[model samples]
Target chain A: MATLELRRLRKRYAGGAEVLHDIELNIDHGEMIVVVGPSGCGKSTLLRMVAGLETISSGEIVINGECVNAQEPAERDIAMVFQNYALYPHMSVFDNLAYSLKNRRTPKDEISRRVNETAQLLDIAALLDRKPRQLSGGQRQRVAMGRAVIRQPQVFLFDEPLSNLDASLRVQMRQDIRALQKRLDITSLYVTHDQTEAMTMADRLVVMNAGRIEQIGTPMTLFRKPATRFVAGFIGSPAMNFLSGNAGDLPGWLPRVPEETTEPLTGDISIGIRPEHIALTTPNAGQIDGHIELVEPLGSESLVHVRPTGHESRLVVRHVGTEQPDAGQRTGLNLQGPFHLFDHHGQRLATRPRLADTTCSMEP
Target chain B: MRYHRPGLDVAAHTLLIIGALAFMLPVILAVLASTQSPGTLFSGTLPLSFGTSGLDHYMTLLTEPVRGVGVPAWRLMLNSLLMALGIAVGKLTIAMLAAYALVFFRFPFRRCCFWLIFMTLMLPIEVRIVPTYGVVAELGLLDSYPGLVLPLLASATATFLFRQFFLTLPPELMEAARIDGAGPWRFFIDILLPLSRTNIAALFVIMFIYGWNQYLWPLVTITSADHATLVTSLKRLTIATDGTPPWHLATAMTVLALLPPVVVIILMQRWFIKGLVDTEK
Candidate 1:
């Protein structure tokens, strides 16, 4: 395993349009850094650039202190698991795992031994002689993983490797990949668009938007204190609710924060609070008054969509338990502490740091 | 399934049987004529009865040189086989390489090069036979296998077929191979060639028949009777400038000429259909 670093990495197409803007990251040995973003956010491009499959417009990718900007992908000694598995269609499972070893001129006997070892490790020993098409989607995914791990390269690159499977299979493979990476202790850089997968699998998550790294931190750090509104909105399930007014507009909103860091809330600002953080009280009992517009029950919790008075947007309040307000019933949205305040430019405001930490620690 | 109609089924069977007989009758007539003696063949109005000179006629044709054409039937068949195999293998090689370069690599004027190759589909050997023969003669490749096969090797049809096949392959396969430490040549040989086996077999069947049936190009280029192909020799045997044409030998040679292509088609029939229709990748 090796330390992988991306410093001021940028990518620009021949048409002079930039896709990745100064991406700077450092992945330590045995750390799995998952880059999560929407489509066209350049996360896959970033992974490809590190794999040497794409040209770096500028900056250097240093793996184990060696700059691999000029090296071929083979010379870089990195294995990548593509989203579609990308298994050799005509080659059997054993040959697919053994292809790189054979290309590297490994001895035939050693290749077979290593291939069998990998097959056994993946629990695909019976599938060694079967071609990729003969295998199911989950089987193919295992073969793809086996191909990467058998090489034991300096680093592993995964480009949304679990996105192709069904919902249950994706979750299973997500855990499988995480456990495999942990067991092998290989430094890995994985890219995906699924926020839940990122939250569950990444040692540290790099949340990206519009070709820029919005925030990079542990999954809990990103969930608790997203550095920007985009990260706030992108990192969570059911997403954080963004209100069009200042947090100061709600009565008793500022008093909840500690007095030391609570500045006079002024200027055009947006308030973001997690769906689970907002509490539903009687109409007019809370900070802002609203009528529940819709309620979607999801087993253990419910998503309550409430429209604040004289507002066009709906705030999705994640209410725990099966009890939910009726769609047309008046409900008061209490502005719980640990609120995210964003400036007009969607940048996170610098207030409420102390209250955020205290409330974050207090939550279950 | 569509509704089963007994009357339509009977009509369809009648039409198919007639079509099958229409196709098979000439071949049967040729086989029967090859077995007949010269006197019986000349006396005849469609001699359906089998004659006794079948072995003798075949032996004579196979062992001795024809009257006008100076090469034995086996030698002509051998030349035709060499030409067919050469053209089939050479066309596939050149076309595969051309398609590989076109599809996989990025170069300046790559599309232009592809279009230039595609334009050759408009000019077949028959259309460009004069200049082709000129080039062959100038290169002193006349009366050689290369002369017979070289002019037909730039197969735009084969190249297009391969390019289409290559395009259907996902681009991720190439990236995966590259990450696995396979260079361009290794990837081509180990991955691309094996994947293209069915396509190569299909094209071989087509190009072999095409090369075997080539008449005008070989006839124009080959002056030596020893280098004459079976098709061209058949023409020589029919248009005997000195006397009545050797119909018996011509029929026997025609029968022999049909065997190789038929065998190739039958052997590769499965792959030929799969290559055209199967979306295995």
Candidate 2:
């Protein structure tokens, strides 16, 4: 177990074009930090740098209080699970898990003991003698996990390990991975493009966009109070709705806008609210009126798409059960308390602090 | 599924049958001549008759010697096998290592080196024959096995095929091995090489056939009769005196020289086609 600290970590190609810029993060021992982003956001690049598969263009990576930027992957004492489950296709499961120990020249008995224990823990003991091609996707994923477990490295790096499995298997394996990580108490960094996986798995979530960290917090903290407009839009399923409305038009539910705004709201000031936070009421009982455009019933919950009058923005509301207003039906939308407001530059703006004792306050 | 045009299929089959027979006619003639007596050869009276059906001519050719050569036929067979094995193994191993380096590693001028090597494939060996002969003689390797084997060791065709094959492999496999504490050499030998057995087998068969049928290079290099390979020795046996040739014995010796490459092709016919098809993909 070790604390991994990356101070001003940077990466660039040989011609000096930067891919990752000025990354600073500290991962405490036994913490699972899930890095989530879009495809070209450099999450995988950052993981590869930590695993020593890629060269760091600058900055120091310290593992367990020792700088490991100059060390080889093997010398850095870390293990990784790849998205394809990169098991040696020709080797049996036993040999696949035993390879690292064999490379280190561990005694035969010790290697067998460790491999058997890992297989039992992963519930893949029956598959020990089978080649990787013979196993299904989920079984192959377990074999990949077993290969990393037997080594018991100081940190485990996962690069979308569950992305290759089917939907049901992905959920099962995700839970299994979290449970295993907790039981072993290993420091881990997991990279994925799926926000749900990051939300459900990480002790801390790092939301990235365009090679920069947009926000870093607990999963609920990110959901409740995103630091930037990009993080707010990138962390949710239907994505937070952004309405180009004047701050002064929000009526009395919102606090009064500062007279001399430190960061002036020019052009289009954006207001963001989660889909589930918007409520439907009688036509005259709410602040804004819109007509329902589409209704998607997801059994337990429904999504209502609304087009507000005199505004080009489309708002989505999460309604419960199968009960939903018909398309073209006029309805009212009430903004939940303390919505996120952003300036034209997409940076979050300051709002008045909520009353501490108000139980219905939106600040989490 | 059946073709919609029956007439076109029938025409296609007819053309294919004629082409197939055209290809098989020479081999059929060679086999028929190998069984005929030396006296009946070149009579052109009855080419495929069963009159002389025994292996008597094959026995005579195997035991007898050409008048000027003074060497039995078995010695020529041994020399050919040795040369073919040496050249095949040498070329395949060197091509594999070079292809592995070009595919996996990063170094200065790597692309330049690959292009230089690949450019050799466009230049025919016949164009460089005189310069190659001079270099072989200056190195004092004329009339030697090293002289025959070393010049053919670097095969751009084989290197290009293997490099293209290696390029399609997913990089994640190599990355997994690195994270598992395997070094570059270990990762290649343990992971990449095992997955490439089909390719190696395919290259082996192709290189073997090429070395077995080689005529021009060996003809220019070897001067002594003892150092001559099978094809050159067979040529010496066929040029007889009195402007008349012993067609039966000459055909038998030709069959002997063709046997190994034929057997290799039959055994690995599937892999040979696979190698060619994989290159296009």
Candidate 3:
């Protein structure tokens, strides 16, 4: 019955710049929700608000069955891991982990037990007595995680915890965090600007844009059916390629809607298709054609950038192989994936396009 | 170091040695003169050789301490020690908490408050000594240690230094402590104080010396022998109402007054250097 709910949460500065607007979320017990967006998206602000580090302008935050809006962070029974790994430079790793427990007046023996268990869990037992300055970046990150875990708090707040590490270390720590969060089954709210981290680590991803929730769902659901054009463009890697065509079907689009149809997509409607969804076909063989501009072969899969024959916009196709066409080649792009169409207002089109007749199973 | 000229290096070394000896000559002269007869002072010719009566002079000042112009030597030294330690600790306490408030907490007109405190630095005890003395007398603290220490604490130099240091501390540490269930004071004592060790040590040395060298305020305010400080007493020991002052006894008192400050600096030198260097780093 454990639950964390954010109802009508809003944040505005004294200058009346609203940074978070109507953020409504229900995070059940043991759920790991990663709030992700571009810079200045207020994702970190939302997390800090829930952690009681920032005040909510007008809202109620319910943890379990109690409203903790006015409670101090310590009384709220939550823990936070910061981006800089804010380890106390003076204390050893052991003391860092034992800090909260010690502050709570936990018995000395219990403090040692909890610190030892957390260090062992994070595989940092050997570095227990070393100062934070003595450890490497990855080790410090682990200690930060251990500090949060030692308290056994009801919720965990992470503010871009892996953003400071090297590339390889970032990847490793992402897995470590996900595994640890699952093992503890702690209700956690993680924030990051990296789409990959959001997708890989989140049980449910909250997509924010310009101070509002664009969409919230599992990573697979958001990837397959992004509710808004921004979500579609932001969810996938290399971002979903967007093309605005004239009233008619643009290049790389299936010619499903008849020219004299009763209702048609009008008024600057845009199409969103993932780069991996577009496939390469022979010249003039596919539903639409384009001229290949650049082909970036990344060993296993290649990204082929093409300027559609009819529209001035360029689209990318994630071709899955070492073999790919070169630049300046005339090719047909198969418009076969789940097509996302946005209206002139950038809202997702309510109905999926009935263009499956011309689609092929090009799932390479 | 990269472009060292042999001749210039030799010339520079010779100049620095001469400068070092030049600075030491006055101290050496005072010591030699203090060893001679008590009456040998301010004469056209100065004594260069040491006399055998140096111990007798210091003993006279420390034990016999000429009748009634000042307090006993041991009592004056104790008073000075208490005053120095009190001021050093008091300034640090007030400065650290004030800097904490100025840096970590947001209030109305915090900048205005900091600037107002900073304005006091220009008005040392010298400029406002009369007003300060009246205030002390009004409060019935003319001969109290608090009177001596409180006025000095109003200076903002240490507060400014600490504010700069506290500003450099990552804000996340505060947030982290807050999340860890540490209240403001707990955070200060547990984490902030530990991190500020070197800075505190350095401030202790400087404040001790400043407190030890305070002669004007003590001389003006402390009219009793009970609260007479070492520096003021040394000055009083130099004057004679009816005859030439005793040079040997005055110099011996000066030499005794220098010991505590030098000892403090020597003890805290390591932390002083490390704290100053590592803070910005």
- Give TM-scores of the second chain, every candidate: 0.93, 0.88, 0.90
Q: In model 1, what is the error at residue A175, expressed in angstroms?
A: 1.4
Q: Pick the candidate with the highest lDDT.
A: 1
- Docking model 1 quality class: medium
The predicted structure with the larger lDDT, 1 or 2, is: 1
- Candidate 3: residue A282 Cα off by (Å): 4.1
State the lDDT of candidate 1 residue by residue for A277-315, as single tens digits.
788888867767888889999989999999888778888
Position A347, candidate 3: lDDT = 81
**Residue A56, model 1: Cα distance from true site in angstroms:** 1.2
When candidate 2 is compared with the true two-chain complex, its DockQ is 0.50
Model 1: CA > 4 A from native: A246-266, A353-364, B1-3, B270-279
Query: TM-score winner among the candidates?
Result: 1
- The global C-alpha lDDT for each of the candidates, from Candidate 1 onward, is 0.88, 0.84, 0.85
Per-residue alpha-carbon lDDT of model 2 for A73-187, expressed as tens digits?
A: 9888999999988888779999999999988999999999999999999999999998887889999999999988899999999999999988999999999999999999999
Highest DockQ scorer: 1
Tell me how far the alpha carbon of residue A22 in candidate 1 is from the true structure, in angstroms, after superposition.
1.0
Of candidates 3 and 2, the better by DockQ: 3
